[model samples]
Target: MVNSSALSGNDTESRETLYQSKFVYIAGIAEMIVVILLILCFCIFVCFNALILNVYFTTPHVHEHARYVLFVHMLITDILYLIASISLFLVAIYAVYIPMPICYPMLNLAALTFRITACNLAIMALERYVAICYPLQYFQFCNAHRANTSIILMWVVGAVPNVADFFAMQSTVEQDFFSRNVICDLSLLAVNPLQNTIRTLTFISTFTLVALTIVFTYIKVMQVAKKAGSGTSSASKAGRTVMMHALQLLLCMTAFISTVSETYLRDSPVMLLITNFLVFTCLPRFLSPVIYGVRDEVFHKYIRTFCLFNL
Candidate 1:
């Protein structure tokens, strides 16, 4: 008769092999789903931004306003942000490990774009304030040239803190059985106390200032709108537009918070963190075009027209 122990051992081995195979299959399916979602997000992002840009450029009335100029700059930043995010997602999927030179630059660009986006929102709030609270001076104060200059200045200012981040980064090579690559983990930037302090201060200060400006300006706008009676129906409309922008700003800030806290979340499951990051990144982009299209009359009119013609 066959030994019972031997048969039992063989059964156990077979069960182990089956379990491993099933795990691998499940993991592969999950990866494929992640990739498909990323592609879908990329397509939607490009399409929405393209729609806004087309409307801004093709319609003379839309382009004449300074606010649309800021919107265009914001859209450019979102495109860059999407590209950076896509690069990171691809690296995570395909690369055994990302090299420091590759990783740091991508992260820094992402950070810079995020900062510029915040600045753009604050500036947009100021523009709205001027338009609503001080209507007579809106044209004189917020002309196209000034709007363009502000956009340039936003990029320049946004780059300063990220430059510090680039210099402060440290990297080392990590090795697996088959391959080795440099890992410039962002948490390393915080290892240096001074660098960490600087980064924290700059981040908090920049965002705080922008947030305060937006809040204060909107409060003033609302006050003016309330006081101006029925003659200021446009002011009420502008308030709704500003409210949409505020919602967009809040969404972006939530993403920023998630990114900043990533180091603290090192113990969390890697896949979970990645999934959360992707949601935060895509949510704002998906909603931005919708918000603008619904809230802004010119954008709404053009989007409807374009949709109908295409249909």
Candidate 2:
């Protein structure tokens, strides 16, 4: 009654304070729900990977084939990739400052496994191409012994850019670089002009070669399928397999490019989490079990028992 303006000001301030608090409370709950969902999905993938791997190991007929061996190798590489990626995510979310020495290995492992995963898809396509197009030479060209050797070569091929980036960072920074503690991030490794340039150039060159290899394999396989003159021939199926691999490679490339997209998304934690985790990183790995593991008649037959028992 005495001063209506002052009373209105107090009421407005109280409402604004309450609104701010409610907004924060809602944001916290939403972030927690997202994290829980992420963890649940991750665990499910791990279990599925384990079940498939167990079946592969326990069944001699399945594990003895060159194609199955290659499949197993891909799964193992993916598991490594998933573990490394999730570890990085957890640390980032918790704001844990890990020492450089410890963090470097984890970061590089993530990078290395990512490269290996892409290479694995390319090699697997080539394996199918050889099996279908040149059946007579399949045993010689893509046998289990050769499959194991290819896995080793994949790691070596993947390590080149990582080693180069490390040396480049070393050249630019002081010797005490390893003594400090910082958040484990890919951007941290690319902190210098030289490192960023190398990263960009390497990304362009390496992925170009990978894409070309996948495209070449897919085309060759398709040509062989057409010449076979039968819709149900192994060549046709192999052609489809190569196409599937191309899709998986596309997913992997999407994850790599997320680092580039982070600039626009840095301010929004929710956006970054969704884009990086759901769309790019985990989507490909999650689809692997569905696309290949469940769809393969042989694999499906073997895992049916395990699924029924576990269900």
Candidate 3:
């Protein structure tokens, strides 16, 4: 009777282990599905953005200096965003399958690109501000040769800190293992006091500049509209369009802050999920195409022209 009882206990234990294994397998599969969905959405955004930019560039009539510069920067940022999303999706899928070696360098590189592209939206905002605020100075301020140099500097500034933090993180967290399934916690980006300081400062500065740009642009746009009165229908529409873009930019900035804050604070699941929703779940990217397409008279007209031509 004792021997029989021992054998039954062993069998029960085996069944429990199998159940746990199956649960883990299902969870992994679920995670993969989510990741794939994210990748698909990102790819669509990238392709659509590319197409719009191509139309803008190929049509000489639409290629004014201001639009040309904005188009180039938008294309570059979207491409970077696409690449970053791909990298992140791959990392998620890998985490579902295998133990990810703490890839600190790659994590920082991705973070840097995302952050930089985000921050560079400020430059675009600034351009729009100048264009609306001082129409006469627009040509002098946004000239192509000068714009090219500024764009290069913006990217460089965004990329440089990642290189520094990558090495710094390796130095500090190289031996630390947080989880069997974990890759890298970019929260360690704040481990170096100096990097943390600089990052915080950069975030504050970028936020202030972008916020000011939006405020100033709206104020100037409103003033112009008020002056023109009934004759200002076109200008009012343009102001509304810019206001929408500014709102989208605000969403992107909010997402970035939420994600970074959650990471640093090591917040609860609810907090993390909210951050993820803002950062990854099709909100900002969805707005990207809308803001650009609806606000851009050229893009709207050009798409019509293209469709008509094809028809």
Candidate 4:
């Protein structure tokens, strides 16, 4: 009876080992797929942004306008955000331990870009509102020079929460905190409860304000479009464009759910990979080229010409 019991115990242990190995194998495969998809998407969008910028800069009539200027700003912000975010993700996933001194600034830069992207969206919406609602004086308020200056102001405003976060991080950590080697992650940098609260509140408030601004612009543009009285009217087109910016903002807002997903779906590795890659990392950044450049009549021709020339 003793020997029989020993054999059964050995069998149970073998089964458990096999189960764990299988899970590890599956998790690895899922991670590889996610990384490949992320890299591919990032490269494609970067190229598209570059192509649009090239066209805009080379054409004087296109580049001189306030709308396209704002559009280019959004593209640049997206690129910066993508670089900071994807670099952090790759570092964490592959377990590249970075010193906190080097990592903190990176995390803060990512946070700042998040705020700036929303600010850019709001500014672009305001530009459209002025263009359609106050056609005669649109240049007075949303001129190319002012658009460039507003981009600078957005950077200043966006840096505020990050500055607060840095102080909050300092309050909790030890004197030698910068000497620690750690996986580069937003969660790691934001480990302090105060930091988390600040991030959550900041995200909600900034995005809410941006969404409201976009919505207001869309409504005003729609009212003007009605008076203009044609399906193909420029006012109607501008309304749709403002609506597109809102849709992009909506994608940005969906990232708020990552917090919820982490809480509930954290244990499911595959779901975590998909959610982080698709929702939190990639989707919002890709929408800018589609919404701003491809959808614009002036830019579309340039894109087509570029594509055909390349072909």
lDDT of 3 by residue, 1-311 (tens): 99999999999999999999998788667656666666676676776676687876787755556545755576666566556545644544244333435454456555565565555566665666666667788889887766677777877877776667656555675464434455344553456677776667766776677677667777777777777795556456557755765776766665565455555554443323433643653457656675677557777787677668976
Tell me how candidate 2 scores on lDDT.
0.82
Better of 1 and 2 by TM-score: 2
Which residue pairs show collisions in model 3?
none
TM-score of each: 0.87, 0.93, 0.73, 0.88
- Give the runs in model 1 whose Cα sits over 4 Å from its true position: 93-101, 166-181, 188-191, 260-271
Model 2 spans with C-alpha error above 4 angstroms: 1-4, 269-272
Worst 10 residues of 2 by lDDT: 270-279
lDDT of 3 at 223: 78
Q: Give the per-residue lDDT digits (tens) of candidate 2, residues 86-163.
A: 788778766799999989999889888888888888788888878877889988898878988998998887898889
Which pairs clash (backbone N, Cα, C closer than 3 Å) in model 4? none
lDDT of each: 0.75, 0.82, 0.62, 0.82
What TM-score does candidate 2 get on C-alpha atoms? Answer: 0.93
Tens digit per residue, CA lDDT, model 1, 1-311 = 47898899999999999999998888778767876777787787788678888888888876778899998888888888878866775565354476656676787887788878888988998899899888899899998889998988988888888776545533322233113244444553354566677677887888898888878887887777788676548777777767777887887777765676665665764555566667777667767767776567787887788889997
Candidate 2 Cα deviation (angstroms), residue 169: 1.1
Better of 1 and 2 by lDDT: 2
Consecutive 10-residue window with the lowest summed lDDT within model 3: 266-275
User: Each candidate: how many clashes?
Assistant: 0, 0, 0, 0
What TM-score does candidate 3 get on C-alpha atoms?
0.73
Candidate 3 global CA lDDT score: 0.62
Q: Which lDDT tens digits does candidate 4 get at residues 163-217?
A: 8888998888888888999898776776589988988899889988998899899
Q: What is the lDDT of residue 207 in candidate 1?
A: 83
